[model samples]
Each structure stands twice: as C-alpha cells, then as structure tokens.
Target: MALLFEYLPLILFFVVYKAVDIFWATGVLIIAAIVQLVYYKVSTGKIETRHWIFAGIAVVLGGMTLAFHDEQFIQWKVSIIYALLGLSILFGKLLFKTNLVEKALMGLFSSVQKEQEVEINIPNAIFNQLLVLWVFLFLSIAVLNLYVAFNYSLDTWVNFKVFGLMGITFIAIVFTMFKVYKFLPEEQ
Candidate 1:
C-alpha cells in the first residue's frame, strides 16, 4: 500500500501517456505528485525528505516540459531523480557517517520484528554491503535510463520507464531479500 502510493505518480504518468501524449501525461504527473505530497502531509503529519525532493523535481521538470513544449525535460527527470538518490546515499555515508540505506532497512525490519516477536540481527558488515549494493543499483538505473531515453524512441522510452525499470527494481528487491534471508531466525 505504501509502496504503491510512492509509485502512484509514475503509474499515472504512464497511463496518461498511453491514453493521450507526453504533455498531457506530464501535467498529470505533476498534479499527481502534488496530490501525493498533500496526501502524505495530511495523513502522516510530516512528509519524508525524499518525497519532497521527488515532488520538487517532478514539478520543475514537468513544468519545463509543459512550458517549452519539449518532452526531453520530462525524460530527464527519471535519471535526475535516481542520480540524486544515489548521490545522497553515498554522501550520507561519506560526509555524515550515516548509512541511510541501513537506517531505512533496519527501521522496516524493526517494525516486522516487533509485530512477529522475532529477532533479526543483521551484521554491520552486511548493512555496509547492502548500502554499496543499493548505491550501485540506483546509479546503474540512472545510467540505464539515460541510455534508453537517448537511444530509443519516446514510445520505447515510456514503455521502458514504466515496465523495464520497474522489472529491474523488482528483481533487485528479490535479490536483496535473498541476501538478507540468512539473518532470519529458524522457524520453531
């Protein structure tokens, strides 16, 4: 549910693009992003930094796409978002001595542990490896988006954005889960 909420704008953009065109789709994407932010703020009382960053980029890039009547800006948004995310992860570790990936993953696991009365102890070394894995994953996806956007047609790019990138992300999640599975306690 929360995951689906995060992808709502992208999903809407893809659907709108398929039904109409890039410009219309871009407008819907912008509106959807704003709506998402508002919804999150209203529901959670505070929106996450990442959500703000994503919404800001969407509005700026989507606005440019609409203002200039060019689809290139919208196409660039995906790569920009991923690049920023990857950089944030890298810098958080290097400058702040904080591992954002580990924090997020641990927060998630903590909630599950509380609910199921299970203790999952993942080592710091494992978290470090996962952090590197995610940074590379995001950077690779950013590069892949740029490659597909420039080398392919708009239609192809849209399809890749909606389906191909999602497929890659899904695979990465599965891979991460497998990597962490050894840390889980054995069933009684």
Candidate 2:
C-alpha cells in the first residue's frame, strides 16, 4: 500500500499519457505529485525529504513542459531526479560518513521484524556494499534515461520511464535480498 502510494503519480502519468497526450499527462503528473505530498503531510504529520524533493522537481519541470509546450523538459525530469538521488547517496557516504541506503533498508526491515517477532541481522559491511550498488544503479538509470529520451520516441521513452526503470529497481531489490539471505535465521 505504501509502495503503491509512492508510485501513484507515475502510475497516473502513464495512464493519462496513454489516454491523451504528453501535455495532459505532464499536468496530471504535477498535480498528482502535489496531491501525494499533501496526503503524506496530512496523514503522517511530516513529509519525508525525498517526497519534498521529488514533488519540487515534478512541479518545476512539469510546469516548464506545460508552459513552454515542449516535452524535453518533462523528459529530463527523470534523469535529473535519479542523478540527484545518486549524488546524494554518494556524498552522504563519502563526506558525511552516513549511509542513507543503510538507514532506509534497516528502518524498513526493523518494522517488519517488530511485527513478525523475527530478528534479521544484516551486517554493516553488507549494507556498505549495498549502498555502493545502489549508487551505481541510480547513476546508471540516470544515464539510461537520457539515452532513451534522446534516441527513442516520446511514447517509447514514457514506457521506459514507467516500466523499464521500475523493472530495473525491482531486479536490484531482488539481488539485494539474495545477498542478505544468509543472515536470516533458519526456520525449524
């Protein structure tokens, strides 16, 4: 449910794009992003930093696309978002000695562990490796987005944005799970 909420804007954008066109879809994307932020604020009492950053990018780039009557601005949004995310992770680890990826993953699993009465202990070394993998993954996706946006049709780029990126992220998650499986306690 939370995962779906995170993706609501992208899902709506793809649907609206298929029904109408890029302009209408971009408008929908911007509105949906704002609505998602509002919903998070109202429900959680505090919106996450990533949500704020993503919504800001959506509004700025999506507004440019609508105002200028050019899809290039909207197309560039994906790459920009991914690039910033990758850089944040890289800098957070290198300069600040903080691992954002480790924090996020541990927070997620910790919640599940509390609910299921299970202890999942993934080593800090594994998380450090995972963080590096995630940084590379995000940067690669950013580069891939630019390549597809420039070399492919708008429809193709939209499909790649909605599906290809999601697929790649899913694969990465699966790979991470495999890497961490050895740490899980065996069931009797």
Backbone clashes in model 1, listed as residue pairs: none
Which regions of candidate 1 deviate over 4 angstroms?
A: 116-118
lDDT of 1 by residue, 78-168 (tens): 8998889889999999999999988887787886788779888888888889889989989998999999999999999999999998898
Error of model 2, residue 23, in angstroms: 0.3
Q: Name the candidate that leads on TM-score.
A: 1
lDDT, candidate 2, 1-188, per-residue tens: 99898999999999999999999999999999999999999998999998999999999999999999999999999999999989999999999999998888778678667777888888899999999999999999999999999999999999999999999999999999898888865653
| Alpha-carbon local distance difference test for all models | 0.91, 0.93
Question: Mind sharing the TM-score for model 1?
Answer: 0.94
TM-score of each: 0.94, 0.94
Residue 131 alpha-carbon offset, candidate 1, angstroms: 1.3
TM-score of candidate 2 relative to the true fold: 0.94
lDDT for 49 in candidate 1 is 89
Error of 1 at 172 (Å): 1.0
